[model samples]
Target: MTDFNRDALGPPAGLVATMRLLLVEDNARLAALVSDGLEQQGFAIDRYESIDGAEHAQTIAQYDLLLVDLGLPDGDGLDLIRAMRRRGNSTPILVLTARGGLDDRVAGLDAGADDYLVKPFQIPELAARCRALLRRPGNALDSVLTAGNIVLVTAERTIRVNGQAIEATPREVALLELLLRRSGHVVAKPALENALYSMEAEVTPNALEAIVSRLRKRLAAAASNVQIKTVHGVGYALFAPPAADE
Candidate 1:
């Protein structure tokens, strides 16, 4: 197991909103504990006690991360990693097992695991490793979203424009994030409403409209090169402003 001196911080709210993880471990107690810890950090986790179970689950759901134990009840976890890589699944995988030998670590990496953690590891350490993997370049999950001169740091829930940081209300931040995620594509008004407020929450009819309007003005005032385009009854899209010539 790897140890760290400092405690690990939980993932940011915006990053956690979309992350889904698959944890394949046979020990029910450990699985439950790890699942709870990750959930508190804003992750959605699915647990599987055997290699066969995880294999089946992967066919139906997309996961942002995978935590696999080498000593599975049915088969070696490396086989699952190999299979996923063979099928072009690039989701980051972290091996969580009792295998502490140097060769074991090398084998795990060679078998397509992004990082390896031995048994008895701290939950915070595990979570930190997971975060590092997701932030890796070329991975489907990124810690930041960028459009022109505007950058949204998903982990910190902060926005920057032209190298300057800007403060935004929670609602405004949520609205901008939803549009930024679907940049260059239309995000329907209904979807925007859902993103801003929960289904059970009582939302005023014009609540979403108000949030969008405020965010639009803030972005413009900040001189952000990105703009949010309203699609009338449809929705909105975030994108770079058109060239002056166009």
Candidate 2:
């Protein structure tokens, strides 16, 4: 619930296309192909080679969606899925195994997976399934979002710096919500544009820059360490994670 305000300005385009995905597979070639195809579909994918790899991924990586292959070199992929659930990881998991039987699919989903895919699936199908799974609208939460000294409360539409509520416009609030939603990962410009301005709304580039500049200032006021980095030819990311030197 990190408080971030959307700029009054948004991109002229209508499509908001950015998602973070986790991919687990043992087949090197297939994993590469799947990762590439999903990336082309506007998803940021993180891949792991085995159940053991996924087990570690569970600790360090955060994902909006998951693609898992049941056959792993180290052990049953199901075991990893089960382990993740046991640890209270609700990141959506979709089994992509060679097993096509109903019982296998049932077992996987019943084990707390959100979706399942059989082997030899088409790329388009995979993309479509992923979109469907990620379609859930996020609920505004009352819990505080703490990135160091910055805190945000989605329920009250309020933002505080070092425990002090700061004033902001509604536009800034929306922009900040998107940043918090996609925090810990890069959020491209096109996606921000769509979220801010509808496809029907027309916007100028200068306006876009002005809005982001305001957001950057607000974040700075919250903490000197806050940064909204611009990725040349890509988009912007509100990254508050510790710097490499730290």
Worst 10 residues of 2 by lDDT: 1-10
lDDT of 2 by residue, 59-165 (tens): 77567888888888888888888888998878878889999996998998888888888888888788767866887444222244545455677777787777788
Q: Across residues 111-194, which tens digit of lDDT does each residue of candidate 1 receive?
A: 999999998988867776887787744332455877778888787889899879998987777777778766677899998898
What's each prediction's TM-score? 0.51, 0.49
Off by over 4 Å in 2: 1-17, 136-246
Error of 2 at 45 (Å): 0.8
Clash counts per candidate, in order, are 0, 10
Q: Candidate 2 at 236: error in angstroms?
A: 41
**In TM-score terms, which candidate is top?**
1
